[model samples]
Target: MKKKVAKFSVLPVVGASIFFYSFSTNKAQDINTALLEEFKTVNEELTFEVPYSPDAAVFDPQLRSYPALGKSYVAFKEALGFKESGGDYKVINEFGYMGKYQFGRGTLKLIGIRDTNLFLNSPDLQEAAFYANASRNKWILRKDIERFEDQVVNGIKITESGILAAAHLAGPGNVKKFLRSNGTNSFSDGFGTSIKHYFKKFEGFDTSFVVPDRKAKANSPSVI
Candidate 1:
């Protein structure tokens, strides 16, 4: 009987040991499988090509490309357009100003742009309108331009392009006032954009392409 009891006890102990060994083996296999999965995920992530250059430069495809328009008429118009409407031809401001150069309805009529909707939709017409208005303003402020060109007023050097831009901001009459008063008779638009600001910002550009005409019309063959 003692021998049988001892043998039975040994059998249970051996069985328990085998059960613990099986459990530990399965747990180790599960842990190894989890580690392999984690490693695979990391490897997959690393396999993707990273955009890299020696200079670490990144390029955006959506951004507008600025070509070399150095001080030309194109440069001056583009610079003004960017400031007025971010070069968007269809934009209209809150104060009833229309198109890329932000022409008021009255100004548009003066430039022979009768249809406001047509002016808003047509890029060609808007461009023509800008040329006509600039020409008219140039004609109106010709004396002022000649008088003030190269003279420093309010610590800002005056230029023909600057005078034209100032006239665009605040009509030729107001520009004349501002220039005559040595920048003291300041004028700002509804958005508080001042003539002096435009004067300084748009100074020193070749506006010789714009021919001065008192009765300049957008639809006129010469302007178009």
Candidate 2:
């Protein structure tokens, strides 16, 4: 009778142990499922929360640098700025050319920017000055652009943006002489940067945003 009692007691203990083990296993599975669901929710939120724009400039992840800006107007301006003052808005060269696009005091006066210090300090004013100057140059070289575009002068193909850039480098009158004389009338700056070099380097950019205005001014309603 004692052996029978012992066997029944052992069976009950074993059944309780099995029940506890099953419950613990189920509880662990539920915890893991909850954690996995939380991780997936966080991942989805992260994926959807980031904003994107098609026109925004993209940076190179591996190199941690800005790649080429393509043939856009942004590319043209930034590239010219890089070439001029290494894209520094506060830089003044030895020849007194100021700002990112390196405008001379005389040139700034032509664009209605009388205050040289204000023009140098204000980035918005500098940008407006650049646009204004480009527009004036475009107007000055309109005939030359129409005549020399796509034509190979001195083995370099002429483009509208290139012509404007050359005008920026050596003035519109010099650019006109260069084009009319088939590149023989080339002019260089104080740093020996030639008009032909500017023409070749800044070619093939979409500068159509610049309207040819003979009277373009920096403070004008149209420019700013």
- TM-score of model 2 vs. true structure: 0.70
How accurate locally is residue 83 in candidate 2, as Cα lDDT from 0 to 100?
94
Compose the digit string of candidate 1's lDDT tens values, residues 82-122.
Answer: 89899888888888788898889899878877788777888
Per-model TM-score versus the true fold: 0.70, 0.70
Cα shift from native, residue 212, model 2 (Å): 0.4
Error of 1 at 195 (Å): 1.0
Worst-scoring 10-residue span by lDDT in model 2: 215-224
Please list the residue runs of candidate 2 whose C-alpha ends up more than 4 Å from where it truly belongs after superposition.
1-62, 65-68, 220-224
